[model samples]
Target: MLRVFQECPELKLSSHGRKMAKFGRATPEIEGLVVASGLSPLIMCSLDTGDRRLMSTFVEYWHKETSRFHLPVGEVTITLDDVTSLLHLPIIGVLHSFELLHVDDVVDMLVELLEVSIAEARVEKIQCHGSYVRLSWLHDVYQMKI
Candidate 1:
């Protein structure tokens, strides 16, 4: 019943690689805090269909040992944030693209995507040229070519 919208990188920080200790700890107290803060929007938004079931489900999702969230639509991941935080790096955004790739080409495509994502200062138009990939945004371009 889990829809994967994003995938987590196979990287581990501690023995409990799947578990996000900080977020897991924070999940339990989020509801109470949001409620006590008089944030009706937060509560209402989470409580879609006027039922608390969805909100509880989201909270449960957050409490999972893994950093993936499975909602009715698709999965959401914290892998980017996790990776960036681990490296003490700052991130402005994340960009990912998926297509029906041939089995033999998927890994190569993924690597290319990651390279393009990292090289570009900002994400915009992503174009592929033979063995090279290009990413453009407004007028700024990255130093990496291909």
Candidate 2:
């Protein structure tokens, strides 16, 4: 995932605060909270823009097995083993810490992520607001149109 972000020429590390984004680094306590709240860990990636502002986007949690898998199915605990297994889960909303980024750059970065880090995920749909972008990824699909 880091390698994919590194390939983007437009992506640079933020200089002021926490310089880089961390992936799958949720501590045990944090994971426990997320599991209890039925909240999946949404993978967030950030980059520094030309103007020295931070640009970030939310990508589906391709590796959120810990929290998402242990959900209760009626009386039984069911594990979602497939990457696209969470299609039935409702996306409550988009969580944005700062202003959303442009659609094109977000799209490009997601494509790179799919191509590099997660080779099995598929982009099912892309919803673009004026500032924010939301994407849905399905089960394994070899070729991506984008």
| Candidate 2 colliding pairs, count | 0
Write down the lDDT of every candidate, Cα atoms only.
0.40, 0.37
Which of the numbered candidates is closest to the native, going by highest TM-score? 2
- What is the per-residue lDDT of model 1 for residues 7-48, given as tens digits with 9 covering 90 to 100? 544422223222222222222344466445444232222211
Pairs of residues clashing in candidate 2: none
Q: Which regions of candidate 1 are displaced past 4 Å?
A: 1-55, 81-146
Each model's total of backbone clashes: 0, 0
User: Which ten residues in a row are the worst by lDDT in model 2?
Assistant: 54-63
Model 2 alpha-carbon drift over 4 Å, by segment: 1-96, 116-136, 140-146
Q: How do the residues 1-146 of candidate 2 rate in per-residue lDDT, one tens digit apiece?
A: 14233233453543421321312244455456656654453333233356432232211222245443221232223354432354344344564365566655555544554342322212222333343323223112222322
